[model samples]
Target: MSALQEELILSSPYQEFEREEWKDLNGQFNLNLESTDIHSLHALNEPLNMKEIEEIYFPLAHLIELHIKNHDTIRDDSNSFFQRNQQKLPFIVGIAGSVAVGKSTTARVLTKVLSLLPHKPKVELVTTDGFLFSNKVLLEKNIMNRKGFPESYDTKKLLHFLSAIKSGIPQISVPMYSHLEYDILEDEEQKIIEPDILILEGINVLQVTSQKGQNNKVFVSDFFDFSIYVDALEKDIISWYVNRFESLRATAFQNPTSYFHKYADMSLLESREMATQIWNEINKPNLHDNILPTKYRADLILQKGSDHFVESIKVRKI
Candidate 1:
């Protein structure tokens, strides 16, 4: 490819914002979150300070609020045009990223802030982890090593769940996944009852899984009113994964009931090596071949620097 072709290929339909510029967009809105609340929101090894909340997430929350309002307005207009009373569906937001990229914290903080908006919207969070096939099923399929891959997920069930929610069904129940147990909690379920907004976070929420020649194909993202992708360099993500693994080795992994309990006996260096090996073999491949390709599909992208703080944001121009 020539230089012109390369430039065109690299160009994106996004308006980029530096951290300082983005903070200004928050305006005079007061986020009523206390220090304790902020502390509670941080994921393992993911540093989220008030500075980040104020500068990065506050603006993001503001933008999502606008989208929600717009959705409501459009719904009202459509209902009036059709001369019918239509039930208002929940506004769904999807957050996607690679493992250890901090998308979970983003989803949690966004849910908290969006719920605290002036309208006090009821926000519910659901992770795609719940949709993963059980270990027994994976073993039967011989795809245990590809646990986070698309094939490991029950796409039909996930679609049904999202479809039921979109159809304005009440009292929808979703299975819950336990990180400690490393499997679905068969007895525990999350009840979502007519939430004003639903935030779905996972590594593959933005992925496209439809096969060719399939009529009326629907994807998980088709349910999203807005979407975000948390992004970072591969090296930084590997470092974060290793750091989190080491931290968990000293904590969650030590639990005898934990699926990763064996790792708890490993030394710091050994844990790091194991983490790196896992990332290289599993997460990295998934990130590059599956997750990263969907980054551009997000309505917004939060780009993190080596220090793990969001350095800039990219909003889709169209």
Candidate 2:
């Protein structure tokens, strides 16, 4: 091949755009979410406003719609070529980000918006937290302090659950987790019935864990038709974490049954100090060592500013 041809072929796979550039792609989708909807979906101290949703998330939802349609067509065409009768698989989308970076809120908003689409495809949201090992198991294993670490979860069960969904299983049940109680709920599960779209959101969703003692194994992203990573500076995320802790103190932590209820009575100064310490000791290490490393693996990235609005988007070229 000529030098010029080779150079063109090797152009960057990432095509990044400013927020406005991305928003103009579809030229404004009808803003279906309202104040009540935003209130319901927004996370504590997340700082999400409708302006950011209109300019950032709606466009993303539209792009995912296109991806879903393209995926369906490709499946149909391939199946026709082989004259095989098979169930259409679910379109899996993974949303990964650091703790308190608003990935959950992003997932919730997308689930609602996508459900409002013209096609109105059935959509469901699940978090990797649901697959985490119970606190009893963690205590037994002596990894209670390493709760958010990748090793803290039951990767085997998580793998099996997604495998069942992708294999077109009509019904699958995942374990449930309670943030207030801060433990996996015993004997309770979330039933996932064959949704057209599945939004799998969590801190470790993008992690590509190698299969131990095996060859040619797959990672979680292998099942995802599309994936997103929410991005922000480490400093900004730390600050946000502290703010969220303060907010939750007056809310979730105030409940007598809350695992963190002890923190409810702390002074504002003491609470902030404790939050900062925990971030540095636990969440910060997890983000840098495990979560942030998987950012580029996502099909798209939403880069958030310090104020928590999506300021830019990085799209991976086809």
Segments in model 2 whose C-alpha atoms lie over 4 Å from true places: 1-11, 211-216
**TM-score of candidate 1 relative to the true fold:** 0.95
Each prediction's TM-score versus the true structure:
0.95, 0.93
Task: Pick the TM-score winner.
Answer: 1
Q: Scored by CA lDDT, what does every candidate get?
A: 0.90, 0.89
- Which lDDT value does model 2 have at 272? 99
State the lDDT at 312 in candidate 1. 95
Tens-digit lDDT track of model 1 for 30-51: 6668889998888998888888
* Candidate 2 per-residue C-alpha lDDT over 1-318 given as tens digits, one digit per residue, 9 for 90 to 100: 999977765685778899879888864457557798888988888877788777887888899989998998999998999899778988999999999899999999999988888878899999999888899999998989999898888888888999999999999999999999999998789999989999999899888866344443767788899999999998899999999999999889999999999999999999999999999899988998899999989999999999999888889998
Residue 140 C-alpha lDDT in model 1 = 99
Q: Which segments of model 1 are wrong by more than 4 Å?
A: 1-11, 211-216
Reference-based lDDT, residue 11, model 1:
89
